[model samples]
Target: MHSKTASSSLSTSSRIVLPNDTNVLGNLMGGQLLNWMDITSAIAAHRHCGRVVVTAAVNNVSFNHPIALGDIVTIEAKVTRAFTSSMEVFMDVYVEHRLTGEKKKCNEAIYTFVAVDQNGKSIDVPELIPESEEEKSRYDAALRRRQLSLILAGRMNANEATELKALFEQ
Candidate 1:
């Protein structure tokens, strides 16, 4: 399979935080943000592989700040790395003040998706070629993150996770 650059899989989306999308406190609901993240990341994965994709795991998600109702929420996602059948996507969420026009990062997440056929069986995905310095950094870190996740899930022995072990050794 031919390798594709990170930019080729970049996906961006924006949504208004309507009243229905908010909590009682008038802030965007965490679940709503998660749903948007999933959709945005899946788009990136699909673009990277040009195949049907399924959410395999949500590796990490952090809510740094609260997003108020009426704010413009922007989500940017890109494929950071691709393995045999899965790809890692990094998503950043920003909230823009309608009046001030200021954008602030409110959340970030990492998700994993596996390419699948119509029958739902996992399929191979193309390699991701990171072009920018930031992309390269995320690409390099993906290996360590994968090893740690596997170890935590009990699918891989900690002793065998060289990439993750290196982090503790340093």
Candidate 2:
């Protein structure tokens, strides 16, 4: 498989939060933001694999702040790690106030995707090379996250999670 840098697959999307995108409290709906995050992360996976990819799991998501109507919502995503046929994507969401030009982080999410062939079978993806310090950190942590996810899904036993075991042994 080919080796690709995380920056090569970086994706960013922005949308204006309209009235319809907000709830009765005038804040952007969590579902709507999740949908945006999913799409943005999917783009990053696609760019990395250059093959058809499908969302296998949404590992984690946090709605840290409210985004109001008229705010500009920006979502950034990049591939953090690639293993076999699956890749982990990390996304950060930010909102910019319309009037004050101030920006704040609103959400963060992690999504896992698997590359697939025409017949819907899993296909191997490229290795992700992390460049920046932050990217390297995320890349290293992906193993622990994957182990935890597998354990929680009952696909793997906690005792088999070597990376995760090391964390608590420290």
Against the reference, the lDDT scores of all candidates come to 0.93, 0.94
lDDT of 1 at 116: 96
Summed over model 1, clashes come to 0
Q: What are the RMSDs of all candidates, in order?
A: 0.8, 0.9
In candidate 1, what are the lDDT values of residues 33-86, reduced to their tens digit? 999999999999999999999998889998889898899999999999999999
Per-residue alpha-carbon lDDT of candidate 2 for residues 1-170, written as tens digits (9 for 90 to 100): 77999999999999999999999999999999989988999999999999999998889998878888999999999999999999999998888999999998877899999999999999999999999999999999999999988888899999899999999999
| Angstrom error at residue 84, model 1 | 0.3
- How close to the true structure is residue 4 of candidate 1, measured as C-alpha lDDT? 98
Count of clashing residue pairs in every prediction = 0, 0
Candidate 1 wrongly placed segments (more than 4 Å)? none
- Which whole-number lDDT from 0 to 100 does residue 46 have in model 1? 96
True-vs-predicted CA distance for residue 68, candidate 1, Å: 0.3
Q: Give the poorly placed runs of model 2, Cα more than 4 Å off.
A: none
Model 1 quality (TM-score):
0.97
